[model samples]
Target: ATPSRPASGSASPARTSAKPARTSAAPEPARIPGPGYDSSADAQKQIEAALRAAKADGRAVLLDFGANWCGNCKAADKVFAQPQTAGILGASYHLVKIDIGGNSSANSALLRKYSPSGGTYTMPVLVVVSSSGTVRTDTHVTGNPSLTADGINAFLRKWAS
Candidate 1:
């Protein structure tokens, strides 16, 4: 004789007999130590070097202004290091990370040469400079809150070769 079935709407005992599959724990996100933000370094000299490299490589210069203590800066660094953004940035620009000393007046004074109109004291400001050392005003990106993957990708695409 055939085995009896459970009620029409009920789950049969056989259906519940199988054990649940075990799932492994998800891996932790990588904590990449990005380009260091040096407070004591000469910012101008570093930018000059990057500019020279950019000129030689037929690319632009990307100045990353931020402090190591800024969480937003770190997040932006992560976005910049992503494969998509990194590939574009690597191919089109020479990158220079400059610590702004937490927006000190001295650092602001140094940054004024690139942003003469002011208002670039924000952390993680991205300044795109031509190989000739002219800051591309239209390419200046500020505010870490706006530094999402799409936003960064768009910015890179707009400025990259």
Candidate 2:
């Protein structure tokens, strides 16, 4: 599961002076490290970079589309974190977590562009793409997030080689 990283503002304390005159503080949500990635457009850039990096190493582009608040996605992450899954993913794919809701407009657009036509599906949409930016296969494995690790590896092996 993704850790709730400290917000950038909370990472360090503010410098204070010797004489204290006023005291006023407000509450704010904790800043997470990987939460706010530039913007949706910027996220696409990162995904593109990931794809290019994969092409450089002769690996497949593994697009993992899910929102940050998705419980299924979190569980999927754990399954994907397993030793065997990690080994294969690390060896032959660009495992990218593309957010689908909240501020992830670009990610949602990408999903609609390639996946179903009527509406969006549940979290953890596992899509496989080629180096030429062509989508090979698409599957929604959020039903059994934990069971998707094996399925994901199988997909990569099928196309990566």
Candidate 3:
């Protein structure tokens, strides 16, 4: 038995395009603060130290609030793995990543202690803080900043300036 095609304008068969194979090697990614800091408190301590170091080095603290499941977070993760991005940020700022998944209390506490008034609690949030416990830029990427490095860099420049 032969299968007949659908009648004209009667919902055509589904079609899918075959993607071309990709072989080019992606550039090396930026490595974030690995999991050798000790514990949560230790992480906080490291964060504080980073702030001090940034101040001493005339830089800022960039706090990235995200979880392992977030798509945007995943993208930003790739950005964080980029050497150029890491070098740039490391030279001019302290990069901090917080997994705001379970234990909302910790995330909430951090947010309360640092976030500015009227600041919305959202995932994948990027905050630039000064050494003096001041908020510089609480700009929300709402997605991956990887695609907008220039924009983020511009913001960083303006804030640092």
Candidate 4:
């Protein structure tokens, strides 16, 4: 089971301000934190719950596989938080973000089950599953496009069933 984490909602991108002037003192190590996703979650159970809910609501399940340390995953989260994409997601899909952790093996079984191309998966992979537990789209084969608002919105709209 993966650890419990923040609800799978779209998170706003980190805001960057002007850097503070360096002092004569030694510099501190940079620490960058990405979005919070449950690395210890029971992905199978989550998927089952989502599938049941989606079946009732005539919606699909969106499985987002990535690690919190992944830059591209963070960028994708920002796109998801945008109003246009968020609306579509809320209306049509049950979003589940599965954190792979640094080793990318947190949920290997789920990853392999949904992987369309092969066993290998890139970070921020997306798998769209129908309410009936059928895989509709696997980004492992299709490839995740640019993490732009328009691109994500279009993708969501296209596979929203």
Reference-based TM-score of each model: 0.68, 0.64, 0.63, 0.74
Ordered from best to worst TM-score, the candidate numbers read 4, 1, 2, 3
* RMSD of each predicted structure: 13.3, 16.2, 16.1, 18.1
How high is the lDDT of residue 16 in model 4?
Answer: 22
Give Cα-based local distance difference scores for all models.
0.68, 0.61, 0.60, 0.76
Q: Model 2 off-target regions past 4 Å?
A: 1-41, 140-149
In model 2, how large is the Cα lDDT of residue 104?
A: 64
Residues 1-161, model 2: lDDT tens digits: 13434543344433243123233422221111232112344557766887787666666677777766777777667766767767666666676667775666667777776565435487677777776778777775323223467665565567662
Query: What does the lDDT read for residue 118 in candidate 2?
Result: 33
- Candidate 4 lDDT, 70-147, residue by residue in tens: 888889988887767777777788888887764545487678877746666777898999999899998888889778
The lDDT leader among the candidates is: 4
Residue-level lDDT of model 3, residues 81-146, one tens digit each, is: 566666666566777777665565666567556654545555677788887758877755333243
Could you tell me how far off, in angstroms, the CA of residue 140 lies in candidate 1 after the best superposition?
A: 6.6
Question: Where in model 1 is the C-alpha error above 4 Å?
Answer: 1-36, 102-106, 138-145
